[model samples]
Each structure stands twice: as C-alpha cells, then as structure tokens.
Target: MTTLFSTMPSAVAPAPAADQAVQDSSPSLPEMLIAWSARDEALTARSARLPGVAYWLREVAAARTEHERALVRVVNQHGWPSVDLVGDEAATAALRILLHGQDHAFLLRCRDLIAAAVEDGACSQVHLAYVVDWCLVRLAQPQLYATAINPALGRPYPVADPDGLDTRRNEMCLPPLAQELARHQTRRLAS
Candidate 1:
C-alpha cells in the first residue's frame, strides 16, 4: 500500500562511511533533510518485510537505531528545521523522520515544534494531523484522527470514535478513513 514510505527515493545508493564526516560538517537544512529522507526510505523498505522474516525485523530495528542517532545529531545541531528555513519537501521529509522516530520525548518536542510551524503557516494542517495522530498512537492513546496506519495490516489502526473520524479528518483536509483504507487496499491489491 502507498504510504509515506512510498515517497522515498527508490534507488539512492547507501552513503559511504566517509560521508559521515561530510554530514558532521553541519549540512544545510536541505542537505540534512535529503540525508534523513534516504535513511527513512531504507528503513521503511526494510520494515515492510519485518512481519514475516526475523532477518528483516533485525535489519529494521538496526536501521531504526541508526536513524534515531542521526536525528538526535541533527536536532542537537539545529532546532526543528521548518519549511520556511528549508523548503516544503525538505521539511516534510524531516517530519517523516520524526514520525518514525522511536524517542517519545523527542517526538513530543517535535510535535510541539511542528504545531508552532503549522500555526505560523510553515506547515500544512494535513501533515500536522498525521504527526499528532501518530504520536497519539505511539503513546497508547486514542488518536484524534485515524491517520496512523498499521504497517503489518496495511490499514489504519482502530480509532476512538470511528463514526466521527471523517469529520476530524476533513477538518485537517484529509479524506475520509474509508476512502483512505480503500486507496491503500487498492494499491496493495495492485501490487
């Protein structure tokens, strides 16, 4: 099914070890975003196979650890990068990294930052909704909207109020949950 993972670069080569030094040299916001996007793409591709294979799960876990470390380094070097500072695509890539991140505290901090960015018109409401709902799902709380997906199931997870989910989603400029699920199902069946 198509997901944020679907937008990742499909054929980008893995960065060489020496590239770590280049990354450490304080890359521009767009460069950092591109690097994170590649890492996120690799992690997502690995994670898709994790359910059926132990090896894939290990790879996904390892990639997650590496991704987390890289994100921490980026945040430490520069506060939450925004669309205004970078560009729409780059900031969206950075947001995707935060969405998939394992650090709860860091994700919460990013949520706050993204919320502010949205208020400042530096981010889209649709993206904010995804991040907010994802964080909620991660926290074991009921999501505001069913934007978070169950990768294994290839569909959205259960929501607190299914009947009103579309109303909430509509407010954020997202389509109804049924439409989203159908789209995912269609993509899966096609593949």
Candidate 2:
C-alpha cells in the first residue's frame, strides 16, 4: 500500500541530474543511505501488518540487494566512505546498513572503517559497539559489549560478561543493559 515517500518532508528536494551523474559514476554514499532508509522504513511498516505479503517482502529484499551492491561499489572506489567524505549523518546511516547486512566480510571491513572514524572523532562509539556486537554474534563469539539486541527474543544477544555489559555500554554512551532489557520486556508484555 502506502507509498513510502508520501509523507516525506516537503523540504527534501529530489536529487539533481548532477547528483545522479555522480551516483552513476560510483555509488554515492549519502544517496544510497537515504534510499536504504526509505526502503527499510517501508519494509518495517508493511511487514508489521502484512508478514505474509510476498510482493512487499520481495520489494524490500530487492532494495536491500541494491544497497549491498552499492556498498561494494563504494568500497571499491574508496575503502569506506568516511564522515569527511559523506558527512556524519550519511556515514552513520551507511554504518547502520552494514551492521544489519548479511555479508560478514563487508561488515568486517565497515567495522575497521568505523573504528578509524571513532579514533578520528568522526563517528560515535555507540555506532561502533553495534557493529562489533553484530560481528561477534555472526562469528558465534560472545559479544564484548551488549549492544546488539535480538529482535525476536526482545533482549540483548549473548554477551561475554553479562555483569560487565552495562559498564561497557555506559562507556559507549548506551543505556544500562538491565534498563534496555527491561524496556524490551515491557514492550513484549504490552504486545
């Protein structure tokens, strides 16, 4: 149903021809991030009420596939698009996509980039913690920090030190694990 961009703010302008040219030349990080966000939002909304809708699911999957391809192109052109290159917001959004992506190798590359970005004070530790936890979980290793939440279970994934999770989370500007877990539990109960 509803079009994804129907409610988009009027202030956001359509991409210009020159911007399209740049994207055609190579994957534009900011543009791709924006597209990913729109598609992700659409998928989230539709999936919540129409879980069995194959068409919507296919559309979302196609969008994700496009994002993955664009990510590869961006990486090929430049190791990773830093905040300096794509701006802080776009870089953060790009990192979010990679964190949730299925390609472990690509995620690892993005993780290294995020680490460097954090060192340069270009990105936040909060973002880095998510990717780190996701990578650890993907590798079947315990997460050092409990940043990755298990959506289905409505809780944080397995952590190396549950007791120390909140300490590490606090260092990364994240809320305490107990507090987050409680919030998730509350939401589950409500649902």
Candidate 3:
C-alpha cells in the first residue's frame, strides 16, 4: 500500500545530493542508487497527510520527475542494471523509480531487462512483478500481477486472469491477493 503512485502524503524536499551522487564518479551506481532510494522514501513518507501542502507536493513531484531523469541518465550511461552489476539493493531502487515513471515505453523496456535479470537469478521477482503491474496499469491494460492499485479505492487495478491471480502473484513472490488486501485493510484500521 506504500506505492509511490498510490497516493500523496505530506512533503519532504528531495536533497540535491541525489543528482550529485548520480553525477559523482566516486560513488558507484549502487551507492548513488541507495542514496536515491532513501531520498525518494523520505519524500514518499512525508507525503502522507495532504492538507494545505499542495506547494510542497508539487515540489515533491518535480523532484521525483527529476529523479526519473537521473535514472534515465544512469541507464543510458551504464546499460540495464542487475544485482551482479549494481547489487540487489540498487536494482530494487531502480525498479521503484520505474514504477512511478510516466514513460510507458521506458518502463516496458526496463521491465524486459528486469525479467531477463530474474531469469538469471540476478534480481528479485517481487520488484519485477510490481513494475510489470505498474506498466500494464499505465497502459490501461489488465495487470498480470495485482500489485498496482487504485489508492483511493484501495483495490488493485484490473487483473488479467482473476482466478489465477494468486498463482501468478505467488510465482512473483507475492502473497495471495486476498491476503494482501486483508493486510492493507488491517493497516488502515490500525492507522
């Protein structure tokens, strides 16, 4: 339920150091990517209660968009990243950024790369599942996995095969959809 695109929280300014980390040669992609994920999570966490925080929200979105650009540059300079190349943490961070990316083609292309990495046992299938689900949601197509959801409704986006959703999700390292939804509901009640 803590997806970047799910809903806006409050606000936190993304530090300029994210770009610096990406541009700096001293820190490898893994190092910079880890920093990027930290910053992005901060922003996402700060985005929880959205009341009279539109300006900060806009700033947050702009920063995230800038993050997408930096990610693109990272991909351009160093081919598709993998656990072997950038490490598991960085690879997961890379996919998280892609989940919020606006470009469908770019997301799809990276999805393919992640899929290959999964086959090689160099990446986590859970992250790849979220990416594929996000890609299909953006395209208005039924997602094979039900990770992508409508935050307002607290329901997953349309699924391709309803009966086999849990099966597909299990293959991708996800809990059954009903269990997932129940967890979300529990969290909501607790909050």
Candidate 4:
C-alpha cells in the first residue's frame, strides 16, 4: 500500500540558493535536461525485475528528487515553461522529473505551466494529465487521469470516476487503462 508520495524521496534537501556560476562553456539547459532524465531512465530500465529491484527504484527515486531540486532551483530563477527550455526533449524531461516529484505544490505549478505550454504547442498535452494525477495522488485522493502509479503495488493509484476513465485518458491522449495495464504486464514479463 505504499503510495508514491510516501515512498519517494528518502530526503530531498532544497537546492542551495546560489552555486558556482554557470560557466560560459557549460552545457546548455537542454543538454542538461536530457542527461538528467537519461541517467534516471537508464537506471530504471536496467533495474527492471531484478532481485532488489525495489531497492534500485527507491535509490533512483531519491537521486531523481535531488535532480528535481536542482531543476527547481534553475527554473525558479527563470520560470517553469522556461524560455531556456528549448525543444520538446528538454520540456519532456522537466515534465518527467516533475511527474515523479514529491512536492505537490511544485507539481501543480508545473501542471499549470505545462498545460499552457501544450496550448502554445511547446509541450505535450499528455503531460498535463499526468502532473494533475500526480497532484491528486499526493493528496491521497483518487487521480482523474490514472497516471499516478504506486510502484510498490506495481499499479496505478486509485482512479476517480472509473466508468469515465477511458474517456478522460483519451481526451488527454493517453492509452486506455486496460492497454496501459497490459503494457505494464508485458514489461514485467519481459523484465
């Protein structure tokens, strides 16, 4: 019964207010974004279904949270849906980091920003549903979009309005719950 909110982030300290100035030669935000997300994805993909996979996932989650803390610091300096967040890859990375986030407030902020980004054709509309669902799950309420998964349970968190789930998922451009469940099963089997 470990909820995502309860299980994530063994501890995520707020990013320090100031750090070494970005070297003019430093990698751009888009590159940084891709690297950050790729690091986590590689870890998760590699750990799939191995013994102590949960341990690996938790480790990844904790490390990812620290990354998010850095993201927050960077974005806060500019803004969410940042002008510097050029390209879909960078934007999508931001969304993925926020999706696994423990901070409900930040998730909501990113949710709204992402929705606006979607309307502006800068971000995927699908991300809006997920950030919203993450917020709901963090509150211990049923998620509307069925995007928040409880990794411990290997299932989505409780979904509200079950009868209309597919409709909502479709509107957000997500696959049907059944389809997603099947996909999850396949991933587990393949793992």
| Model 1 misplacement above 4 A | 1-12, 16-28, 46-52
lDDT, each prediction: 0.71, 0.70, 0.75, 0.71
User: Model 3, stretches more than 4 Å misplaced?
Assistant: 1-18, 21-27, 186-191
lDDT (10s digit) by residue, model 3, range 44-106: 555655546665566567666877878887877665667777877888877777776677788
Q: What ranges in model 2 sit over 4 Å off?
A: 1-31, 182-191
Model 3 clashing residue pairs (backbone): 9-47, 9-48, 10-46, 10-47, 10-48, 11-46
Clashes of each: 0, 0, 6, 0
Model 4, runs deviating above 4 Å: 1-27, 45-62, 81-84
lDDT of 1: 0.71
Residue-by-residue lDDT tens digits, candidate 1, 84-134:
767778777777767766888888887887788889988788778988888
RMSD to truth, every model: 6.9, 5.9, 6.2, 7.4
Candidate 2 local accuracy as lDDT? 0.70
* Model number with the top TM-score: 3
Q: What is the TM-score of each candidate against the true structure?
A: 0.77, 0.76, 0.81, 0.74
Return the top candidate by lDDT: 3
Per-residue lDDT value at 160 in model 1: 82
What's the distance in Å from true for residue 28, model 4?
A: 2.0
Q: What lDDT is reached at residue 114 by model 2?
A: 78
